[model samples]
Target: MNGESKIKINMKAPLKERKFWDVIVIGGGASGMMAAGTAAKRGKSVLLLEKNSTLGKKLLITGGGRCNVTNNKKDTRTLLSEYKGNDKFLFSAFSKFSVEDTLNFFNSRGVKTKEENEGRIFPASNKAEDIFNVLYKYLGESNVTIQSDSPVVSVTKEKEGEYFVVKVKKGETVFAKACVIATGGVARPETGSTGEGFTWLEKLGHTVIAPDLALIPIALKDKWPKKLSGLTLPDIKITTFLDDIKQEVHKGKILFTHVGLTGPTILNMSRDIGELLKYGSVKMEIDLFPHLDHGALRAQLQRLLVEQSNKKLKNVLSILIPGSVVGPLLELASIDGETFAHSVKTEDRKKLVDQMKSIFLSVKGLLSEDKAVVSSGGVELKEVNFKTMESRVVPQLYLIGDVLNVDRPSGGYSLQLCWTTGFVAGSNC
Candidate 1:
C-alpha cells in the first residue's frame, strides 16, 4: 500500500515476446484495467500496456488519496442524469454494467466500501492503494499480461490480416485481434494523461473533441483568498453571477488556495464556471454560514459577541468563523481587529455580518488542465456505440474512460464511467 508496490501480474514473458493477443488494452488506467481484466475473465488473452513505471499513478492521488471508487446513485435514471448532456448516450452503457455491478464486483473481491457525503464510495480503509490493489489483483487473477514502462507509440490495423498492430516506444510490435484505447485525456499531465490516445483516434478517423478543463479550481480576482490558503470551509453556499445577472447556486466544501478556490463545490461547478468565463466575467458570493439567514446570523453573532464583550473583535468573531480568517476578513470589511466587542458600532457590526454573509469575489479564471480532476473532451459520443463501446469509424477499436467525450462531475462519477464503458467494451470487443 505504500511506495511503488510490485505488480504480481503473472505475465508469461516480456510483452513483445508474445506472438498474438486476443485483446490489447493500450492504457493501464482504471478503465484499461477493467477492460483487460474483464476480457481475460472471458478466456481471452489480454495485454495491458502502461506508460508509467507502475500502474494507477493518477489513481493514487485521486480523492486526495482516498480514491472515491464509485457514486451510489444506483438507479439508472438518477445515475445517468449526473452525466449532464451525456445521459442519453450513456443509458445503454449503464444498463449493461450498472453502478450496482461495480459495487458488487469490488465487494466480491473483499474490498469493503463506505459511503460518504454526496454518495461518494471509498474503500473502508480510506486508501487509494486498496482500489488499485483490487484491480491489479483482478488482472493477476485473470492472468492479464502487463507491460509497464512501455509507452505505446502507435496503433494501426493490418490491411490484409485485419489484425491491429501496436508499436511500443522501444521498437517492439505486438498484434491483437481487437484494441481498446483507455488512454485518458489531458488532465493531470503528471499522471501520464498526455492524450496520445486522442491523436491515435483522430488518425483512425474518429472525431475528437478539443480537450478542455473540467472539475477544476477557480482562480479569484481578489488576493485575500491567498491569505487563507489551505483553509477548508465546509457547508458554504456560493451564488454565481455573470454580468451581475444571477446564474447558478451551489453548496458544499471549498478549499482556499494561493491563487483560487478548490474542493468539491468549486470542482463540481468549475465546468459551468469555465463556460461562463467564455462569455464575460463571473462573480461569486460566498456565504460563510449557509444554514442561517441574515437576521439569524446577526443574532447569533450578537450573542457570541455579548458573551465575550471585553474581548477583541477579532477574538470574538473567531467563535463565529475560522480563527485564521478573522484578520484578513476583518481587514476586508474595514473593521479594526483590535476594537473591543462592546465598543464596536452598530454599523460596523452590520458591515462585518454583511461581509461574512456575502464575501464577494470575481472569477479570474479556471485553473489549467494540470489542476483538473477530469477533462471535458475526447472521442465524440455519437460516433461510438454505447451498447458495446465500439468506435463506429474504426472496426474492432473501442474507446473508454476519459478518451471519450463524456463531461461528468467529480465524486466517483468519472470512475463509474470507466467501469461501465470498460466492461461494455470488454463484453463486445
Candidate 2:
C-alpha cells in the first residue's frame, strides 16, 4: 500500500463526473483528516468533504490553539483507563495505532513536540496550526481530494450493494465503495459538530444516543464565585456531595469563572456532577488548604494575627491567601477586613480559618454543549466493531471520533481516541 499510486483529480471538473470512489469521508476535523490521509495513503481514492470553508477549524482551536498532539501514556491499559468504562471496547483499535504511533506520526514528520504536566503533548512552537499543517500536508501528499464548504445533506446506501452515495448540499452527488462517518458530536456547534451524523445513522437503522455535555465548566448557584473570575488556584481539593452525603473528592487545578468553576479539575468532574444533579442537589466544598488540618490552619492563622497585629485584618489574611482574594473572601466569611488584627475576636478568627479551609458552593448544573470540551452521547459502544471502527448495523459504513458514544475526560484522551479510531478505520476500510 505504501508504493500505491496517488489519485490525481482536476478541481475544475464537476466532482460528480468521477461518479465512483474507493472511499468518502464526511467531516474534515481531527479524525476525518487522519482517516482520509491513512486511507488515501493505502492507495484508496478518498474524497474528504467538510461543511466548513477549511479543514481542521476545530483542530486549530483545540488546547487553546496549541493542539494536544496525544497523551504521553505509552502503556495500552493505562492509556485506555482514561476512557472510563469504555476501555474494554477500545483495546483492539488502540493496539493497531496506540499513543506512541501518534507521537511518531507527528515527530517523524519534523513536528517537534514537548510533554507538559500530566503527560499532555503539544507542539514545541505552541501553535495548533503546526499540527494542522502536518495533517493537511499529509492529505495533500497522499492525493486525498478535499471539498470544503460542502455540507453533506445525506449518506444513503445504493439499494443494491455495499457502496455509499454521498449527496453534498448545493454541490455534487458522488458514490463510493466505502464511507467513513467522521462527523463529530454536538459539542462545539460553531466548529461544525452539530450531531447531524446521528440523523444519518438513525436513518440507516442505527440507534443514536441523545447527546449530552461531558467535559464542561460547572455553573454555580451563588454569585460570589463571579467576583473571583479569572482567578486560578493551582492546587486545591474539591469534595462533591449529593443530598448532604459525601460522594467523591478530586484534587486538581481550578479556575474561577464568571458563571462558576472550570479548569481541569472541574471539567473532569462535570459529568459526575451532572449525574448527581439528576437525583438530588449537588454541593461542592472547596479545600483551599487540603494539606493542613483544622488545628494546623488555625494555629497558622493565630500566628499570623500575632505577627501582623498592627496591620488590618485584610492585610494580615493577605499573607495566607492571594491579596486580590482577601476582600471578597472576607465578605463571604462575613468578617470585617478593616478590623485591626490585634482586635480580632477569637470567633472571628475561627470564622476566617473555617472559610479558608472549606469554602462552600452550590452546584447549579453543568454548562451546555456549546461550552463543552466534548459531548457524551452518540452511537452506542455495542453497535460498532471497535476493532475496525465500522458500524455493525451497516456494512461498509464506519464511525470515528465523537460520532461514537465513548466518553473521555479532558487533557489529551479525547484527541487520542480520535487518532486511534481514525487510524483503525482507515486501515480496515
Candidate 3:
C-alpha cells in the first residue's frame, strides 16, 4: 500500500488488545516518537503516550521555530565533547546512532536538512513544523499507537515477570514487556515537560539527580549593566570565574539581557556557572573587543578622539559604541561624560581602553528551571546501559532523552541526544 493508505490503516487500529505490547514508549516527544517508530518498524507492537494534547509542542518552538535537527559534525568524539555532563556515558549510543544516522533517518522520511554555522543543522525548508509532521507521518505509517493527553502518573513493576504496569491519571493501565521513558526534563513546562517522568523514575528505585537550569540566562547582582539590554556583541569572549579561579572561556555572540547576559557564548558557559553556583557566587567577564589587544584598543580610541577632539565626549563615543554603553564605559574609566575629547586625561584614556577590553558582571544566579533551555541534572548515567539505553537495575526498562543526566549545548545537541538514545533503545527493545 501507499504511504497515505498505510497511515490510515495504522491509525484505525483499535486501542483494545488482550496481549501486552512488545514496547510501550512514554512521553511522545522527540525521543518517544523515534523509539516508537523504530520499534514498530522492527515488527514489534508499540504504543506511545503523551501528556500534551499533541506531540512535538516543544519541538515546534526549537531553534527559533526552525528546529535545529542535528549538527553536521561526523566525528562521534566531537559530538560527545559538546555535551557538558555525562559525555563518556554516550559512547555506545553515539556509535549506534550518530549524526550521519540522524541525517539519513530524516532524509529517508522525506525531511531534508541543511547545516548552518558551527555545524548546526536546520530543516532545508526552515520550518520546525515540517520536521514534526514528517515524524508524525512516519509514526502513523508504522502503526505506532499514540495516545495524547494521557499523563502517566506512575509505573509499577510486576512481582513475577519482567513487565511494567504504567498507571495513568485517568485510571488507565498499560502492561508492556518493554518500556522506554522518553519524557524530557523540566526546561519548558508550557510544552508539557512538567518533570513528571523524573518523579516516576525516582519512585522506581532509581537515583534522580535534582534538575537545575543549565543553558539559561544569568541574572546579575548589580543592575547597571541592565541598561545595555538587547545589545548583541559578536566575536566576544566571555570568561566565567568562580572564587577568583577561571572555569570556562567561551567565544561567540553575547547578548545583554534586561537582567544580565545571554546568547551563544553566555549560554555555553552557563552550564559550568550552574555547577559552580551550587558552591558559591560566580563572576563573569566579557571582552567586548576580543580581536584587539589593549594597546590596539587604546590606539583606536586615541585615533577617534584625535578625529573628534572638538566634539563632546558623549558624541565622540557615540561613533564607537552604542549610546547606552557609552555612559557605563565612561563611568568605568572615571572620565567625565560631559568633557570634550581634547580635555580627556592620558590616564583616563588608558582606563577607558581597559574598560572596553573587559567588562565585568557578577552573576547572582540563573533563571528559573522553566526558563532554562535545557536542564542539567537527571537520572545518573552509571545506572543506565548506554549501549541499549536500558536500566541496569530494572530489566527491560529503557531511559532516553532529558530523563538522563546528559546535558549538551543549545545548538541541536540536546535533540540529537534524543534521536540517538531513542534509536538505540528501540533497536534493542
- Cα-based lDDT for every prediction: 0.89, 0.88, 0.84
Candidate 2's TM-score reads 0.92
Displacement of residue 343 (Cα, Å) in model 2 is 4.2
- Candidate 2: pairs in clash: none
Candidate 3 residue spans exceeding 4 A from truth: 1-19, 84-88, 108-112, 124-126, 241-248, 275-281, 305-319, 322-324, 331-348
Q: Which candidate is the best by lDDT?
A: 1
What TM-score do all the candidates reach, one by one?
0.95, 0.92, 0.85
Tens-place lDDT per residue, model 1, 35-82, is 999999999998999988878888888899999999999898998888
- Model 2, span 227-306: residue lDDT tens: 88999988888999999899999998999999999988899999889889999999999888999988999999999999
**Lowest lDDT 10-residue stretch of candidate 1:** 3-12
Over the stretch 239-284, how does candidate 3's per-residue lDDT look in tens digits?
Answer: 8788878888788987888898887667777767878988877888
Worst 10 residues of 3 by lDDT: 1-10
Clashes of each: 0, 0, 0
Clashing pairs in 3: none
Order of models, best lDDT first: 1, 2, 3
Q: Cα lDDT for residue 221, model 3?
A: 95
